[model samples]
Target: MSFKITDNTKVYIAGCGGMLGESVYQTFTDTKCTVKATDINLTAPWLSYADVSDYSEISKDIKSFAPDLIINLAALTDLEYCEKNQEQTWLYNALGPENIGLIANELDVPVVYISTAGIVDGKQDVYNDFDEVNPLSIYAKAKYHGEVFTQNHVRKFFVFRAGWMMGGGPGKDKKFVNKIYKQLKSGQKELFVVDDKLGTPTYTKSFAKGILEVVQSGLYGVYNQVCNGDCSRFDVAKEFVRLLGLEKDVKVTKVDSDYFKAEYFAPRPFSEKLVNLKLNARGLNVMPDWQEALEDYSKVFIEDLA
Candidate 1:
């Protein structure tokens, strides 16, 4: 029994103001699904107000919409900020899911929870869908806690773990791609990139599309959803510079994680590379290769550059 997201389907999305949420909102609305997207930061007109950490407020909004599905895209993702604010991190990353799960359970509807590849400790070269997750940082611990809660408590749920998310372009991309681009855009001739940290680059467009496709199958379980391949921070930076046609102008220098240790002091895995084994085996994987996705994604930044 698959849960189909038809034209009549109503989706209640929380934290719908981030990079991934932008794509997810577009994807779902394109399908003619009734989407009630909410977030604390109402950047777009289509979005309303709702804080995922606030149980009563978020519950009121979802219940009012009476959505057939609930998608929680909310999380305190800043590693350093999370390290400094453990209480807030736990509230949003952990308890938030529990709140949504309880509501979904009451509504007897399916729920979608977006998770992170950073939950793993980076001990291995790559992680599969069922790999042992040893969360290293406050962010990872809180996120992993949410993942576990959804798996154990939620009756009907789809937990998709995304890797190094790249989307939302210049305005919304808070991840690696935007950070590198900002440096390049600032007329910096030399770019210092880390060669140690490695992960699959999950494009938000592909990831959102993957979510829609996976949910349609009605397969309710946790899946390691990432791009086709993996690379280090250095690989991503070099590639982005080339894509922006700045290879000649900008020099990408490879450095170890120690280079940014003072700034990014949070504990991060050496490898957050996730293999979409489950999604592939189930024939539900729709993620493009990291390079291909990056090339397409570069157009946004290129346009911004011009």
Candidate 2:
């Protein structure tokens, strides 16, 4: 049965303070659902403390809420950090979902787990929803474990694997777009971006909306919920600069991954590009094209510059 997200519906969201969390929070809140959003950071007034790694802490909080739905958005996304802190990464990215899966089983409610495109090694040009994942890094391995855990333990679960995420604007965007904008803001005339990397740009707002739609449909399973198309990192940066009307002011230089091997020491796939095969087959893909999403998202950064 499809669980409707009405005003009275109660949702317990863990790790609701990141770039993606901001959009998820707003999207659900706008629907007037009763939400208990939590994060250790407490970046927003709507967010409270919840360490997802500690099952005891999060289980207590979630059980108290007695939510009809559980969305585990918590993840340690930094590749380098995850590589260095293997144990912590496992706790957050792997065991965290295990905790949520346990609680969801207890409550018998649906759960939403966000996975990543980074899980696949770049041997394939593009990945579908059912591709065999060869996780290359500690972060990817941990996230893949979480995905598998959710599938195995939870009866009704939506594991949405996102691509290169782009949302939350300047204040919250911690991914590629924000990184490029920060360099531009810092008065860098030329931006060196790696063209070797390839992936879909998943807009947070669109992804959040897709989650709501899919969950409401009650078609519960793993889905590749990324934007309609894909591109390389250099393609994204060049388009982003053009969107900001800074094509003349700033120059985007294309380079390979080796250019910043020391800084980005963590193992990354040559291509993280994902195709929304399942979502499209189901007729639930609501994500805009990469360029369209980028243009709309750039307005926030442009305003910040003013």
| Deviation (Å) of 38 in candidate 2 | 0.3
Computed on alpha carbons, the lDDT of every model, listed in order, comes to 0.93, 0.93
Which pairs of residues collide in model 2? none
**Residue 252 C-alpha lDDT in model 2:** 90
Best by lDDT: 1
lDDT minimum window of 10 residues, candidate 2: 39-48
Give the Å shift of residue 288 in candidate 1: 0.7
Determine which window of 10 residues in candidate 1 has minimal summed lDDT.
1-10
Each prediction's RMSD over C-alphas, in Å, is 0.6, 0.7
Q: Compose the digit string of candidate 1's lDDT tens values, residues 64-174.
A: 999999999999889999999999999999999999999999999999998899989999999999999999999999998998999999999999999999999999999
Error of 1 at 56 (Å): 1.1
